[model samples]
Target: MSDLASPPLRRIQRIRHELHRRDLEVTRVERLSPHFVAITLHGDSLANFRSDSFDDHVKVFFDDTPGEPARRDYTPRSFNVQRLELTLEFALHGSGAASDWARQAAVGQRLVVAGPRGSMVIPVDYDWHLLIGDATALPAVHRRLEELPPEARVIALLQVDDAADRRLFPEQMQVQWVETTAELQAAVAALTLPEGEGFAWAAGEASAMAAVRPLLVAKGLTKEALKVAAYWKAGAEAFHETLEA
Candidate 1:
C-alpha cells in the first residue's frame, strides 16, 4: 500500500433545534425586485427561533387551500430574537400557494411557520467559497454574503430571469449573474478552482442543480466540501432534495 494519506476534510457541524410552530403576523412587506417579495413577520412565538446556517429552510403553512393545508419550504432570510421578528423572501413565480400569499401579503396578515428542523453549519475559514444557484437561491445567497467576513474570498454564480432581478452584493466578492442554466453550467465549467481548501454550495431547480453538482466535483471539490440542493422542481409542489455523490 502507498504511504500517502488524504488531507483532512473540513468539519461541518450539524445542529438540531426543538421544533416550534409560530403564528406570526406580517409586520411589513417590501417589493425587493420585479420577481421577489420580502415579508417581515413578528410574534412572541419567535423569541427562541434559531437558524445557524445560511441555507436553513423552514416550512410555511397556508390554510387557504381546499382540504389539506398547503405547506412550502422557505429560507429564513433573517431573524431578530429580541424583536421576535423574522424575514422571508418569496420568489414570485406567478403561481403556487406561497407565491400567491406573498403577492397579496399585507400588514396584519397572519402566517404559520414551522421548524428549520436542523442546520448544517459550514465553517467560514475555508481558503475560498463558491456559491451557485438561480433566482430561488437568492435569499440564502444574500444571507451567506452578508454573514461572511469582509476579507473572506467568495465567488457567486447566480442565474436569474432578467437583469432587473439582480441584487447587489459585497464588492469584494466576485458575483457573476447569468440568465440561463446553460450559462451557469458554462460558468462553472470554466472556473479555475482557487488554491487551498474551499467549499461549494448550490441550490435551485431540481434538474439544474443535478447538472451543476457533477461539474463542481469534476473541478476537484470533494464530497465533504460540497452541498447541492434542489429548492424546487418544475411541476412539483414543495420539492426539496439534496443531491449526494
Candidate 2:
C-alpha cells in the first residue's frame, strides 16, 4: 500500500507493486448494447489474481503485426475465482486501435494483459455514495454496486448516447441517465445529495470531469471523499493507467 499526493486529486494509492503478465484466451464475446461490448477472458494465470478495487484498471496489450504491441487500460468488470474467468467491457464510440480491436474481438483469440498493480480500495463507510461517468465507467460503477453491502445507498448519474445503455443496479441505488456531456455536468451541479457523509466519484471526458470537481467540493463533499478523473479525452489515442487532470 502507498499514498501519493497527486495535486488536485489526493490519491490513496494501494498498489501490489507487482505485475502479472499472462497470455489469456478469449472465451466469450457479447454485445450488451449497440455501443458497448463485453469480452470474457480465461486462463490458468488468472488464478489468485486480485482486483480489490472497483476502479482498478489492467493494462491490455494487442498484437500490432511486427511492431510494438498496442496497449490500453481497462477495468476488470468481474472475476470468477472458481472458473478463473475475467470479464472486460469496452465502449465502441471512437475510431482507434482499442476500439477497432473491440469491435472485431472473437472467441479463441489471445490477449495479453498486465497488472492492476495496485488498488485504491474505498471503504464502504459513507452514508451514501455517488457515481458519475459516461458509458465507459459503467463497469466500475457496477462493480462497486455489487461489492457494496445491500443496505448501502448509492446515487449514480451516467451519460450515454442512448437510453438502452443505462445499467441496472441495486434497488437502493438511484440512477439518473443523461444523453449529452453538458447534461451530465448540469445534473451534477444541481444535485440534491442525500444527507450525511458522502463520497462522489466521477470519471469521463477530462475537460468535463475537471469542471465537475470543484462543484463536488463546493457541494460539501470533502476532498478525501471525492474521486474525480478523466477516463478519456477527445482526440487522444494513448491511454495512461490513471487519468491526470
Candidate 3:
C-alpha cells in the first residue's frame, strides 16, 4: 500500500495491560461551559485508581437505554490522591449515550468506569511542548498544562466552535485559539517553532491531525518527538474504529 493508504506512524509505542473495573458514585456535577460538563466521581472502590498520563482515558458505561448499557470513552481529567476523588469532563455535543448522561448527570448517580489500561507518560524534559486539538481534546491538553513544570514553554493551538468554550489558559503559555474553521492545518504550517528539541502532541479530527504530522517533522521534530491521535472522525460512530486497523 502507498504511504497515504497505510496507517499513520506514532512516535512512541504504547503499552497496555488488563484493567479491572470499578464502581463509582457521582458526587458532584457542574457545567463548566455551554459545551462542557464536569462530573466528579468518588468511592472507596477507587482506592487503587491510577492514571499517570495526561491523555489517559477510561471506559464509562451508562444505562441510558433499556438494553445492554451504553459505553463511551472519556479522559480522566483530575484525581485527588488524598481525597480519592476522580473528575471527568464530558463534551456535550449532539444527543448520544455519553452526551445524554452528561446533560442529566446528578449527585447519587452510580457509574461504572474501567481501565485506563495503560498510559503514554510523555516526559516533561523536552525544551517545549506543542498542544493542538479541538474541544474533545481540551481536557487532556489542560491536564498537560496543569501537570507540566511552570517553566516549560508550551504552545497551544486549539480550535473551538463558540467563544464560551474557551477556558482560562496560563498567561505564560503561548496559545492560539482558532475559531472553528478549515484553516487549522494552515495555522499549524505557519508556526515559528522555538529552537532546541521539542515534542508535539495533537488530537482531533482524524484527517486534520494526519496532515499535521509531516509539517511537524519538517519543522525539526523527529518521529520520536511527536505523538498524534485521532480522537474522532467526521463520519465515524466510534473513535476506536481507526485503532482496529
> Model 3 — TM-score against the truth?
0.89
Better of 1 and 2 by lDDT: 1
lDDT of each: 0.89, 0.82, 0.81
- Ten residues in sequence with the least summed lDDT for candidate 2: 1-10
C-alpha lDDT of residue 77 in model 2: 96
lDDT of 1 by residue, 23-65 (tens): 9999999999998999999999898899999989999998765
Would you give me the overall lDDT of model 1?
0.89
Candidate 3 structure quality by residue, lDDT tens digits, 1-245: 11111122334547674697989999999999999999999888787788889878898998856878877778899999788899999999888878888899999999999988888878786777889888888999999998999999999999998889999999999999987636677788888877666778888888777777777766766556767888777876557422211
TM-score of each: 0.95, 0.90, 0.89
User: What does candidate 2's lDDT look like per residue over 112-193, in tens digits?
Assistant: 9897888887877667788999888898898899888999888899998888878767777788899998999899888877
Ranking by TM-score: 1, 2, 3
Instruction: Identify the runs in model 3 with alpha carbons over 4 angstroms from their true place.
Output: 1-18, 241-245
Off by over 4 Å in 1: 1-8
> Which lDDT value does model 1 have at 226?
89
Residue pairs with backbone overlap in model 2: 15-118
